[model samples]
Target: MSVTAAPGFVAAGVAAGIKASGNPDLSLVATADGKPVAAAGVFTRNKMTAAPVITTRAHLEATAGHAVAVVLNSGNANAATGQQGIDDAEAMCAAVATELGVDASQVLVCSTGLIGIPMPIDVIKAGIPSVVAARSADGGQAAATAIMTTDTVAKQVVIDGGGFVVGGMAKGAAMLSPNMATMLAVLTTDAAATPEQLKAALVYGVADSFNALDVDGCTSTNDTVLLLASGLAGSVDEAALNDAVARACASLAAQMCADAEGATKVVRMTVTGAASDEEALLGARYVSRSNLVKCSWYGCDPYWGRIASDLGSCGIDFDPSKFSVSYGGITVCRGAIDADHDAAAVASHMAGRNLEIVADLGLGTGTATILTNDLSHAYIDENMGTS
Candidate 1:
């Protein structure tokens, strides 16, 4: 509902035959009027990246951050395939650009799913025509649904501004701990903005959401977060636009957390009293990445030891004696463990669909919050020998 929620953007998804499950594996998004729009993107930091990520990066640079369309495919990552992979990615871009009567450099490409396999370029190319033809003003929902891998539900968000709207769609559930950004997210706005404005808004806005998300502490080869400004509704306040973008990103990120692989509850982690904001984030990330801590969370156990131990590994100057931890605002540990709290009350708090884990470093007045999911057997079962 969100990506297409903005004006002047149409989208569609089609079964490209790249997926063995017979699901729609390819999608296309472009301006309704077939014109270039200001765009900016943040991609994966992994050294071994998919072909689409490489192509999109180069195109954004070559075109001066102006693009008319983005073509994406699922089921094959097109990574580690050397020059052929690059060629295939280029062909996908060319196919769309040619059909839309725009320069090849004005098109971006994205791919997700299995890694280290050759992409079915022929099938993807054949599906491009059908995908482009199916573009509709109300097609964002279909596009979101088509990008799913292991996710149980599609994630989308829309925020209305005074004279415009900001909307987005994202697909991600696992392999999430992003370095620069996460997953395949495309955000659009109807407000008039420069390419530089779009870039600054996105680079800063993601820090509040995707940058803080950690599903399994893994980064994929195909992470991409692209923002496009259509300028259909005319000029908008710069501050308002930025805030709208951030809100839309945060909403989608929360959805992704709830839909994480084998996850039951979403853990909202806040690390306070660190030496600095950077240190607080580092501490929270370490705790989020700890499988031991995630397992404890699944058991509804207020195991402060795991949080204390993992935060210490961030290499920050931490004092164990001054550390304290809490779950659902119930202090389970302070200097020494606090055993006077009602056990039933604490467990009941932990059993909720949304739980909070707060840590106090007791060092300084720094704070950071992140979203993660509890570890469960379904996560293991879903990932075993699959990709």
Candidate 2:
């Protein structure tokens, strides 16, 4: 159970002939009764936005953050395709709306896969009826699998929040960075919440989850995270709901990092003692997005100098003498200088699949952690094709 773990939601996925490999490439998530529900979305910060992203944003605005359903297709991002792309996205929404007997304004749309290619609108529209008819409580995993692009495995998370459940699914393997990563996710909950409350919770959840991931330091054009609430479980504590949403998002984000394209190691970079939490995040991101540092991680090398150099050049206010670095609980650099520690022990820690790096500025009481992956030759090979 993923999205369907939350009561009042039904999901489905089907092969739409959109992918050349004939894999399932279209998915749908809707209220069990085919009625509109509260929805809020966070989209990519990229200027070159995809057509579905643009249409979905407008529909959410028009409906005042309420949506009856969401239709998504993979294998063609429907981006950079001009007016026809926009029309195709709207057509998908309309098709779903007609099947549910709802206004088109109440439907949302999403697309992910190769960029700048025209979507197979006819093929997708033909598949919509079957996908809609296939919607069932147990179809969440199928929906999750259908949205995967380069992901080696489907990502899903479910949090049991006592009476209410929070469920979510996400997909992304590369071009992952801040302001939302290269992914599409749908989060659902039966808990009662206003549209504003849903948006606030979603924003807080995304802050340290998807937005904190920096796999390849490349943001995609079609990134979107949507939270839909059915209000089936009435009147839960707002604080508890927020916590559940945050936990769900965190779990999915970690899954995405673990399954990053050709990734062998998951790096957790924590930065502490900064002027502010924002500065700490900036400092941590500087290290996470550093190609040299990622390569060093891949090689299982404890190169503290790379970390130091990135932090120094990140333009954050920190004293050089107060900077320190550690790996796997072992202090490798203290006071911006080499610490007398066992090199063999440090090397041993770096060889593990899960690596931890801690940098303390010794400045103030502010900290942040960024999740990233080590650079690998396989990642390079995975991206060499223009398919």
Candidate 3:
């Protein structure tokens, strides 16, 4: 579903002739009120980074860590293009800044799609004016759609928290992993936030969200999440600001899980009572990415053993006999033994688009939640197929 964009932001998507599919491949997002206090980004952990990632990181730092606009393109990942690729990414951001009457350093750039290809700068340059002209409040959704490579649907979420609003969009279907993904997300909120506060909220949000998922265990060089605060909601209390940011982060995280490629179900895996919150999170993430566990969910098999095995491999200090498992509130394992629940009922619950898997480790008072998708044969086919 397309979400309504937040106020104070304008977005546009245009066909920049980057993708062979003839879809809109270039997108631009900007704040209507000139420069906004920006708390920008986290990129992929991959050593072999893309030129845009390299350049954008420097630009953010060079500008004292502020950006008012972002330009993105798909169908060509400008990685391994060397100095020339860096020039193209910078030029794209520069062009947007020129059109918007802002400094070049105030603009950010991103790219996705087939790796190692130089961006077609001429087409992108030609499309900038049109992209700017098409900008509107609801244009964020279109921008999200334009940045997708293999994603079947554009992912977006909008949350209303009293006087403030937080809205964001993301794209990813493959090459997803912890600390990064093939994904790129841009989030905007009307709340007021200092740069430090913005950065803290984003880091905390991502640590518990995007950094916890793995689709194929591969991290893209261009993975990025950019957050911008327009301060349009005026001076909101700290409590209100926290609520707004939390809602925004939660919405974007859920969108990422739902848009997971070929994913038939979104699993909310919660692990509690571990040695620490970190250990609990580690255990949950390990189980979430397990091929056997995800496939079991896909095939409607309540294989409690796979879940337990995955937890064991996380290296957390926990006793096996004290672990418990439940699927959709039906206890499948209790104290490390089968709970003798109705298998048919559990299977039926697993067939839905959303499933909850809970694990209680009788170690200590710590808890964490991770969102993942059920792996299936179609995920392999879709990702591996020659589109």
Residue clash pairs of candidate 3: none
By TM-score rank, best first, the candidates go 2, 1, 3
lDDT of each: 0.88, 0.92, 0.80
Off by over 4 Å in 2: none
**Consecutive 10-residue window with the lowest summed lDDT within model 3:** 1-10
lDDT of 3 by residue, 61-101 (tens): 88767788888898888888889999999899888888889
Tens-digit lDDT string for candidate 2 (193-253): 9888999989999998999998988999999999999999997988898899999999999
- Please name the candidate that would achieve the greatest lDDT relative to the true structure: 2
> Lowest summed-lDDT stretch of 10 residues in model 2?
173-182
* Higher-scoring candidate on TM-score, 2 or 3: 2
Instruction: Tell how far residue 206 is off in model 2, in angstroms.
Output: 0.4
Candidate 1 deviant stretches above 4 angstroms: none
TM-score of candidate 3 versus the correct structure, residues matched by position: 0.92
Cα deviation of 304 in candidate 3 (Å)? Answer: 0.9
Candidate 1: worst-modelled 10 consecutive residues by lDDT: 335-344
